[model samples]
Target: MIVIEGLRKAYGSTPVVDGVSLRIPASGITSIIGPNGAGKSTLLSIMARLMEADGGTVIVDELDVTRTKTDLLARRLSILRQENHISSRLTVRDLVGFGRYPHSKGRLTPEDAGHIDRAIDYLHLGDLADRFLDELSGGQRQRAHIAMVLCQDTDYVLLDEPLNNLDMRHARGMMQLLRRAADELGKTIVLVMHDINFASWYSDGIVAMKAGRVVHHGAPDAIIRPEVLSAIYDMPIAVQDVAGKRIALYYE
Candidate 1:
């Protein structure tokens, strides 16, 4: 379990994440959904130790993020940011192999090679394994990045807007891939997402945030309600049950 206590981050006089305390359970998909500037990305960054928090503590399992060694933390938790830029030309396999740096330290062993292959297969990048990153499509590149994160073989994974620029089909595929990673690999996947409908459909738990604070957190049925989403987005959102899933109609 990930325990966040009074987490705070600010820029100058304005706060990005304000005393946000949340407990994210293990072995499932939990999505953070909110309007722009709600601090969703900031909170994820702080949780992964990619950014420093002004105050408060984040404990992943028994290890305090602030005190743990960088290598140790990398072994337990992995994060993929929204923007990934690779100046050097890298193949899909080459990119995925980077995840094993904590263990291999640039000298890959046979065991590390096994992890890279497994991650490539899991993300269905076997065919693209030898393909350069720039040669692949946007969705394929995103999958490669996610494959790298999974190759780290961490217990907890944090992703910021994994569905940034994908088409509808690719977006659904990405969510399904993440769902499988959680169920089959026993990974605790936490992601910052923008689409409420996608979050409602795929997430085991939905955390709603507004103005730098979490306003609500619960199951899809609880958080996908008209009142709940309407308040979160500051717009009227109608909820409907379709094929045993809650679908939010926010388009007017």
Candidate 2:
């Protein structure tokens, strides 16, 4: 489980994440959904140790995120940020191979190669494995980046706005792939999502945030109601049961 206590962050007196405490259960998909500037990405960054928090503690499966060794933590957790910029011209395979750095430290063994291959295949990037990242379309590059993170083979994966640049079909495919990773691989996936309907359809739990604080956290059926979503988004959001899933219809 990921345990957070009194988490706080600020920028020049403007609090982005305020004394927020949450418990994210293990071995399932938990999505953080909120409006822009609601600190969803900031909180994910702090959890991955990409950004430092002003105060509070985050424990990932008993390992203190603040105190754990970098290498050890990397082995247990991996995160894909919203924006990824790489100056080096790297092939899709080369990028995915980087994920094994924590274990291989630049000297990849056969096992590392196997992992890279599996990740490439998993993301359906096998055909483009030899292609340069800059040559691919935005959605393809996004898949390559995700494949790298998955190749890291960590128990916990944190993704921020993973659906960016993806078309509707690819977006649905991405969610299904994540679901497979969670159910079959037992990977714990945490993501910051803007699409509440997608979150409702795929997530085991939904954490609703408003103005830097979590407003509600519960199963899809519990958090996807009209009252909860309307309060979180500060607008009228109608929830409908479609094929046994609670889908929020906000476009009226």
Candidate 3:
């Protein structure tokens, strides 16, 4: 489990994450949803130790994120940030192979090779395995990055906007794959998502943020209501049940 308390970050004086506290349990999909500038990405960055927080602490299980050894933390927790740009031209296979660096230390054993292969196959990247990242489509490149993260095989996975470049078909596939990773592999997955209906349908818990604060956190059924959606987003959002799943509609 991940426990956060009084987590705060500011750009000079403008507070982006204001005293936000959240607890993400183990072995489930937790989706953080909010509007632009709500600090959703900032919060994820802090938890993943990609950025330093101005105040407070993030504890994943027994390890304090700020104090843990870098390699140790990387072995336990893996993160996929929103902006993934590789300056060097590399093939999909080479990128995914990097994920085993923690264990292989630049040497790939049979086990490390196995992990890389599984991740590529899991993301359905076999046909494009030898293709250079620059040669692939945005969605395909995104999958390659995700496959790299999965190849790390960490117990905890944190992704910021995993669906960014994915098409409708690939977006749904990514969510289902993550859900399977959580349920079957017992990996705790936390993602920052922009689509509320997807969060409502796939997430075990939803964290709603606004103005740099967590305004609501609960199960799908509890957080996917019309009143709750309106309050969190500051727009009229209608929700209805379809096939026992709550779907949100905010289209004009």
lDDT of each: 0.93, 0.94, 0.95
Which tens-of-lDDT digit does each residue in 1-252 have in candidate 1?
A: 999999999999999999999999999999999999999999999999999999999999989998999999999999999889999899999999999998879899999999999889877889999999999998899989989998899999999999987778878988998899899978999999999889989999999999899999999999999998889999999999999999999788
After superposition of all CA atoms, the RMSD between model 3 and the true structure is: 0.7
- Total colliding residue pairs, candidate 3: 0
Better of 1 and 3 by lDDT: 3
Candidate 2 lDDT at 185 equals 88
Instruction: Flag clash pairs in model 3.
Output: none
Ten residues in sequence with the least summed lDDT for candidate 1 = 165-174
lDDT of 3 by residue, 1-252 (tens): 999999999999999999999999999999999899999999999998999999999999899999999899999999999888889999999999999998788899999999999999999999999999999999999999999999999999999999999999999999999999999999999999999888988999999999899999999999999999898889999999999999999997
Q: Assess every candidate by TM-score.
A: 0.96, 0.99, 0.99
Error of 3 at 45 (Å): 0.4
**Off by more than 4 A, model 3:** none
Against the true structure, candidate 2 reaches a TM-score of: 0.99
lDDT of 1 at 229: 89
- Deviation in angstroms for 36 in model 1? 0.8
Candidate 2, which ten residues in sequence have the lowest lDDT sum?
225-234
Instruction: Give the Å shift of residue 16 in candidate 1.
Output: 0.7
